[model samples]
Structures are given as C-alpha cells and as structure tokens.
Target: MPNSTLHPLASLPNLGPRTAWFLDEIGVATEADLRRLGAVDAYRRLKFQFGRQISLNALYALAGAIENRDWRSFNEEEKAQLRAKVEG
Candidate 1:
C-alpha cells in the first residue's frame, strides 16, 4: 500500500524499483518501518527469502538511511565493524 513516490525508503541510494518492491513485499513499506526492523533483521530476512548474500553496500545504505548518516562517508573499517556486529 506504500507508494515509492512518497516513501523515504525509496530514496535510499542503489535501491531500485525491484528492490523497493521486494522490501514492500516483505512488509517494509516505509523508512520508519525499516528502522523499526533494523539492519540485522532486515538483512537476515532478505538473505532468507532471496537466498542471496546481503552485501555491505546494501546494509550500509539501509543503516545510514535509518541512522541519518552518510552511507558513502562511512569508512571501510567502520562499515566492516558494523557488519560484523550485525552478523554476530
């Protein structure tokens, strides 16, 4: 029921129409919804349903959007640490 035009999740970098649709199908329809679910659960669910690895690119994008940080500005080490925290 959420429209991409008005959804903040749609504004995330690298999240195309297909990815947005996939998120919506999995009950993530808004930025707040995504934030509520958080990165770990979202990544896990995406992996479970899609059978594809959740890259740090996607995880950082989602986390940055949720935390209001600049995704691209995060250092590789910081990103790796965050990913490690989430994965474990």
Candidate 2:
C-alpha cells in the first residue's frame, strides 16, 4: 500500500494529531487543501471550530508552508498584504 502520510504538511508547527484531525474533519487533509481555502477562510474556520484566535505567527507558518516562502523574512509591507488577504 502507499505510505498515505502527508509528509510535507506534517512538518508545519502546531499541526499535531489533534489539529490534523480537525483539519481532516474540515476536509483539509493536506497543505494544498488548506491553501486552497485561502488564509482568511482558514483562519475563520480554525477560530470558529477551535474557539480561539489563530495567531499571526501561526498564520505565517501556514502561509509559508503553502506558498513555499520564508514567512519569517517577510517585510512589513508583505506582512500587511498577507493580513489584508486574510481579512478581506
């Protein structure tokens, strides 16, 4: 049988078993699935389901993983753009 594990997605922080299970329940079992939902929807869903705000740091991590960019190195303008993308 195939390995079946989502290796790349598993590397993201805070994406342990519980979060993974939540994502699966939301029909998002991979990085691509999360990315397809876009940042705003992803955050809203997570917040609503988990009953806690997802932090900017967590957002950065998820975005970085999806876009294959270094989120930590994003400039203020870039960060603003990301925030705008999520908020709008």
Candidate 2 has its poorest 10 consecutive residues by lDDT at 1-10
lDDT of 1 by residue, 1-88 (tens): 3456645566776465556766777789877778789876776777677765456577777777677777788898988887797768
lDDT of each: 0.71, 0.65
Point out the worst 10-residue segment of candidate 1 by lDDT: 1-10
TM-score of 2: 0.65
Error of 2 at 4 (Å): 13
lDDT of 2: 0.65
Query: Best-fitting candidate, measured by TM-score?
Result: 1
- Give one digit per residue, the lDDT tens place, for model 2 in 1-88: 2233554456665454555555665577777788789656775677677665456755665666567666686788878887888777
